[model samples]
Target: MPSLTAVCRVHALLDDSGSVGVTAIDKRPVDGPVEVKRLGVRGDVQASRAHHGGPDKAVYAYADSDAEHFAGILGYEVTPGLFGENLRVDGLDVTGAVIGERWAVGETLVLQVTMPRTPCATFARRLGESGWVKRFQAEGRPGAYLSIVKAGPIRAGDPIEVVSRPAHGVTIGDVFAGLEPEQASKLLASPAPRLSEIVHGLAEKALTRAAVGA
Candidate 1:
């Protein structure tokens, strides 16, 4: 069982040099319990709704182990929330987390794993590193994005409970690596109650693309 080591948030603001004209990628640690809602954590903002936020990506979680891996490579201390994650969890195999897996945060909040965080140019600019997106992809430890299944409050040091795990066995990393039609089909056909319709649609899209050799 993993523990929530830190909670973080940031306001949306303009970044002239970023790939995205504006971003909320500069998150910092927040103390005490914070409200969790359908859209996202209270006070947290996403400048680009199309690529971030909404029901499917309400919360982003990254494992401390993953951060440490980056820190070793980047040659700097990569603290919690530095990567714009809402939660910094310790001992969670974020890359290996299966899609549709549900985790209970503290006593109330329920979150379902949805997808992996795809590195973009905005992330690169935040790190002030060139080819960072490519480097991150090669590292293959993209964190997990979660959807609020049951809204409540979450705080640092909260214990995480695995309420359910989908049997599909497709991990967040698998999706990041680009799922094949067969792999996508298995996930779409899963009996997991936490699996969202949006995920099904994505699997269908992948199947279509595979069929067309796209």
Candidate 2:
């Protein structure tokens, strides 16, 4: 069964990475059930709401499989909250989750898969690895940001049910790795409301580049 392996929240902010004075990337797992609101998991706050948290990015999830893969490369254990994700999912392809896919978390909370996370310098700083940003980007399993549709309490070990998905079939992996021209066309034409400005820009760029080269 696909389940929420961990529920993480920010307890303290990490010192500035560069220009940003602080980072909320250092998240830790909580003991029991936690409330999930429209903004995000309760008690978890980003240092920069301007660049980070928003309605379309209310929650973030990273799959355990991806974390396991990273742990091998990093030569260290990638714990539940290491990636600063609000939910750590087990037995699910979160990276490949289709845009506009609706998930029923536990029972009450409903979430819509929005977009893939773009690696940032703060994320690199969190890893403290050389070329971490590019490396993460290259891996192309950056996980998925989610929009809260129905807010309620969620917890570790809660079952995850994918309730619906847009018919377009464009997945988060395709967007994160850069879509092909055909894939971009599908994404652009899809009426799914979950595609954010960033997602639109990426698809549009793909088409523009294809046209220029034609």
What is the C-alpha lDDT profile of model 1 across 128-157, one tens digit per residue?
A: 898999999999999999998899998999
TM-score of each: 0.92, 0.96
> What global local distance difference test value does model 1 have?
0.88
Model 2 Cα lDDT, one tens digit per residue, 92-152:
9988799889999997999999899988989988888999999999988899999999999
Clashing pairs in 2: none
- The TM-score, computed over Cα atoms with residue i paired to residue i, of candidate 1 is 0.92
What is the lDDT, from 0 to 100, of the residue 183 in candidate 1? Answer: 86
* CA error at residue 144 for candidate 1, angstroms: 0.7
What is candidate 2's local distance difference test score?
0.90
Report clash pairs, candidate 1: none
